[model samples]
Target: MTTTQLAPISARAQFRPGLTPAGLVTVLLGAALPIIDFFIVNVALPTINADLHASTATLELVVAAYGIAYAVLLVVGGRLGDSFGRRRLFLTGLWLFTLTSLACGLAPTATTLVIARAAQGAASALLLPQVLSIIQATTSGEERSRALGLFGATGGLSTVVGQLAGGALVAADLFGTGWRPIFLVNVPIGLVVLVLARRLPESRAHNPLGVDRLGTVLLAVTLISLLLPLMEGRALGWPAWTIALLVVSPFAAAAFVHVERRMERQGGTPLLPPSVMRLPSVRSGLMVAVPFFAAFGSFMFVYAMTLQEGLHFGPLGAGGALTPMAVAYFTVSMLSSRLVARYGPKVVPVGGAIVVVGMVALLCTTLAAWPQVTILDLAPSMVAIGVGNGLAMTTLFRIVLSHVPTDLAGVGSGVMTTNQQTSLALGVAVLGSLYAGFSESLGTRDAFALVIGVVAVLAAIVTVTARRLPDPRV
Candidate 1:
């Protein structure tokens, strides 16, 4: 069904009547910070380890803590926003995020940094979902599409920029702060965004739903079981508990789903209302998101390794190599709204085709130029993928929320973002593992080619699935 045809929710009546350009910009900035933070530490890990004298496990925690907290609490955060006020949660989370970032910057010990990172992640969970919910509630039609497009572009650019910016900040060590600058950099940005956020119109669900305490607990357990093992299994040598948790994760997820379904039957709010899953756009769009983001994560991980270990590029050099992709992605993303408006849902499949072509080109280049490939040699393939990424990502964001009820905007966004984040973590775990295994047996060039081939196949599958999405213009 088209979004316009969906039954109206009581909550939409309470939606603030106006959203200024400045207000939209403020929330968009809020959206960018959490995503950027997710990737910013990748290039700074080694420096953090050296500076803090952290053990390997603690170093891993520095990253894992943030990801786990962010992923686990996302849906709950959405629910909170729905129950409370989006603007209130946005400002509160932003403030907490800023404080935690400062704590991270000034942390003197590895333990302290890990603690601060975890808090930073918790704050992010509270902040990120509201961005999408606010836009979904406050904007419609072409304006909605444009705002969502900018959000997608912000996300893509943040991922690329996080790496590059992190490297640059660490290298510059402005005022002799060293890797501390990476975390500290967010302070001024956050302060500026906070001031701007005052302009945002407050919005909340009309008949506020009470917290789903039991369902929330079950979900936390489910996500932790699944993500913890995947994230830590490789590093911890695939421990028995990790395997056990992985095996139990599906059952835990099933239980959570069962509970949510039961809650719906009894006329209560569940953490993730199963009714939402019945929506074709939400289902198909999320299915497409999994593989798309999985490939994204794997590519970033493998590419970084290939650049640093295989090609011997330093952090700055490796991060810089992705500039072409970053530029292409930002450019296409800015124009994607027009593409979607003109062509509708067909943009996804077309973009997916472009991505496949780009992947093929990248794999071919690596095979042909093994041991001699440079950033310049890879620029064409990177640009192609970037263009594809921009189109697909922007279109997918709009398509997923195409028909969500206004009341459920926060939860819907939470569910979508959670799936994306989980897929990303899986990408690193699964594809990264595959690359590691293949490199040991088949060599780095062949391994990279094989991963690219696998990602290409996945991208092709996403294209096929995209064919099922209803045209947004309809």
Candidate 2:
């Protein structure tokens, strides 16, 4: 290693590397929190229902409200981070999220808790995008890729950890808090993170600009129209209002795009820059990412339901069944930077197939072990899915950002995250709706397998999509 020679150092030059261990931990923690929350509640739903008297619709609402709102506001959040300071916004978001989590824990009624969860999700949107932007602006080359690999690991591991941790929390019922402990746990950790955030260096990638007030309103409306109904509709018995809103979703979505395009033409600040489409890597990566994420997203809910509803495992057992997956995901994801360096963009397509086969194999084992399964019995299948998913998910991330310019890193990241969030909602709606509709007739486990098989086909499509990604735009 070589060091730059300095004749004399100013007092301010002490500890000049901004991407210190503490800062990296801060960013990784921020990125992990929101993703973990998305899955953590799944295993605890039964406990929550018994304790809070929440109906199935309400439980689904609790999850959907957070996810939809986060998906909707994410790009705007990134844009705000760009205009304001990333550090300032990240700290404020962490504080808001911490407070909202406390509110979630304390709410006496299901309605209040759902509202609090939604607010927490919105806060998460504000906090998450800024983490990556800070790292991108703060590092280069090997350092950048390593940070990104850790980010991707956080994304996958969060899902596994959320389920496992939420289960343990509910099972432990620390100080007899029961289901409420899940939300309450975030409060203290969040406070500590926020305090540490104050000393973090402030960074911004763009000149300050007015918030795109109209675009924000339009985008929120579009997402609500599309997302709210799908999640709530089935439980509500597919009301006409749900259908009406869904039918109008395309137009609402169209209006948002039209408005954004007009703003770009007038040289106004758009929430998501239209120019990102000109970059082949960005566009193609999103194409593969959508279906791949759609599949990945549903598996958590589908498999949890399979274990609990189909096989009648308790919360600890249902959530614990995924422990092998978490271990497999972390172990294999650690290898991704090395794998990508060896194989280039080819890693994503190859890994996608491995993941599909692993899913199919897991489903087969699940079917074989029905009605008399233990977590240990599921270990072999779990290991397969875990290793395969670690490979695909970590590699998919590399494929998505393969050519992003450093300056546009935040928006590029926001776009990739938007695709992830949207596809997740889409998977739950479509695959979840399918499972709901068919499970009664086919039985829970069989119906889950059928729906997940359809999801697997979508993953295969993503593999094909990955093949087209290296083509540059004309």
Alpha-carbon RMSD of each model: 4.3, 5.5
Best by lDDT: 1
Report lDDT per candidate: 0.77, 0.73
| Model 1 lDDT tens row, 202-251 | 77766666677888777778877876676567756888999999999899
- Candidate 2, run of 10 with poorest lDDT: 1-10
The residue pairs that clash in candidate 2, if any, are none
TM-score against truth, every candidate: 0.84, 0.88
Q: What stretches of model 1 exceed 4 Å from their correct place?
A: 1-25, 45-67, 106-118, 132-160, 175-178, 195-203, 405-407, 437-446
List, residue by residue over 1-474, the lDDT tens digit for candidate 2.
000000111233223446766888887887777777777877877777777887555666676678767876777776677667778888988988889889988989989988998899889878876787677656667877887667766776776788788878878888878878788888888988887777777776445445677777877788778777877787788899999998888888888888888988998857656777557787778778778877876777677767776787767887789778878887888887788777777777777777777777777776787767778888877787777777777666566666767545555666666667777767776677677667877888789779778867886786677777662211
* Global local distance difference test of model 2: 0.73
lDDT, candidate 1, equals 0.77
Clashing pairs in 1: 11-206
